[model samples]
Target: MKIHSIEAGNFKLDGGAMFGVVPKSLWQRTNPADSNNMIDMAARCLLVENGDRLTLIDTGMGNKQSEKFFGYYFMDHIYDLDSSLKKAGFSRDDITDVFLTHLHFDHCGGVIEKKKNDFYEPAFANSTFWTNKEHWKWAIEPNAREKASFLTENIKPIEESGQLNFIKQNSSFATQNEMDFDILFVDGHTEKMMIPHITIGDKTFVYMADLLPTAGHIPIPYVMGYDTRPLLTLDEKSKFLNEAATKGYYLILEHDPNNEIITVKHTEKGVRLDKSLTFNDLFN
Candidate 1:
């Protein structure tokens, strides 16, 4: 199996929101913020090519929202889904499956697109969109806290398209039926969020998703403010990190701007960032 780093684009998010209760002095050292208190973020997606199936995991926030809506995030267009796919020697039509980690806008927005005459449809018509039944329900009936992130334009179209499918949900991990990977279901970030654990050769590459957005979040206390259950997140992080450190897993971060893949070690301060490597450095 081959893995490709599909960079959707870059955007800026409030550093305070990203780091939660952590002080700026602490987080800023790793993810330095601008004068506006905004930190750089990447909608870094992943593509897996195994046999005849090409699976794209998480499409970055697609350019379908209004300019006013996008202005809030300060999006940079140096890299987008199309160009990144092209660089990977593929196209949207080539995607046979789209495995969404969750239904958050940044992660699933690129799956649907806005078209002429105000028509909305699945961006990858040839692909079977994947999400868990629990998440699909939670997203469609979103709570006030996460309503803004679950846009109607980004979601409704998938169900309407008749191409949406759900991976069977289970207690902790779910076995992916089609893709060559097992899923780790996490809830602190969102309901039934599926983090793919793909084994390629002798190494295991985990799509970190929001469970560990960046290497800076290696500390158990450094949970994102966006997480609904911060306490649950702390517990989840502690358990996952210890296991990952023990197994030597290469974590593929989705939201980290500079660092893509990171390895953690069992340090006195708990599991700490051991090394930061680029996608090419390891995968290539």
Candidate 2:
């Protein structure tokens, strides 16, 4: 199996929101912010090429929203989905599956596109969109807290196209016959957020998703403000970090612009980052 780090795009978000109640004085040291208190974020998706199955995990926020809506997030188009896919020697049509970590706009928005008539459709015509059944229900009937992040244009089109499929939820870790990797479901970030663990030979690469958005969020208390259940996130992160450190897992950060992959170690201050690595550092 071969894994590729797909750069969807980059954007800026309020540092306060990203790091929750953590003081700017602390988080700013790792993820420095600008005058407006906004920090850099990347929509770093992952692509898995196992045999004939080419799975694209998470699509970045696409350019379908209104300019006014986009102005709020300061979207950068330097490394968009199309260009990144081409650079990796593939195209959207080549993707056989799209495994969404959640229905959040930034993670699943690129799966659909708006046409001239303002009709939204699935962008990857030949791919099957994957999401868990629990998340599918939660997103369609979103609560007030997360309604803004779950956009109708970004999600409804997949089911309407008759290409949407749900990976059955059997346990904390579930395996689908069509997928080459195992999925670990966590609920702190959102309802049934799926984190994929792809194993290649002796190494296991775990997609961090929002569970651990950046390298800076490695500390125990550094939970995001967006999470509905912050305490649950704390517990989830604690258990995952311990296992990741003990087993030596290479964590792929989804929103960190600087460090793509990171390894954590057990330090006196709990689990801390041991090394920061770029995609080529390990793969090349």
CA lDDT, candidate 2, residue 113 = 95
**Cα shift from native, residue 83, model 2 (Å):** 0.7
TM-score for each predicted model, relative to the true structure: 0.96, 0.96
* Model 1 C-alpha lDDT per residue in residues 1-284, reported as the tens digit of each score: 68899999899999999999999999999999998999999999999988788899999999998898889999988899999999999999999999999999999999999999889988998999999999999999999999989999989999999998888865323234333487888899888889899887678899999999988888999999999889999988999999999999999999998899999999887899999999879766
Off-target runs (Cα >4 Å) in candidate 2 are 171-180
Collision count for each candidate, in order: 0, 0
lDDT of 2 by residue, 205-258 (tens): 999999999999999899999998999999999999999999999999999999
Q: What is the lDDT of residue 120 in candidate 1?
A: 94
Residue range with the least summed lDDT across 10 consecutive positions in model 1: 171-180
User: Ten residues in a row with the worst lDDT in model 2?
Assistant: 171-180
**Candidate 1 runs further than 4 Å off:** 171-180
Model 2 deviation from native, Cα RMSD in Å: 1.8
- Residue 145, candidate 1: C-alpha displacement in angstroms: 0.4
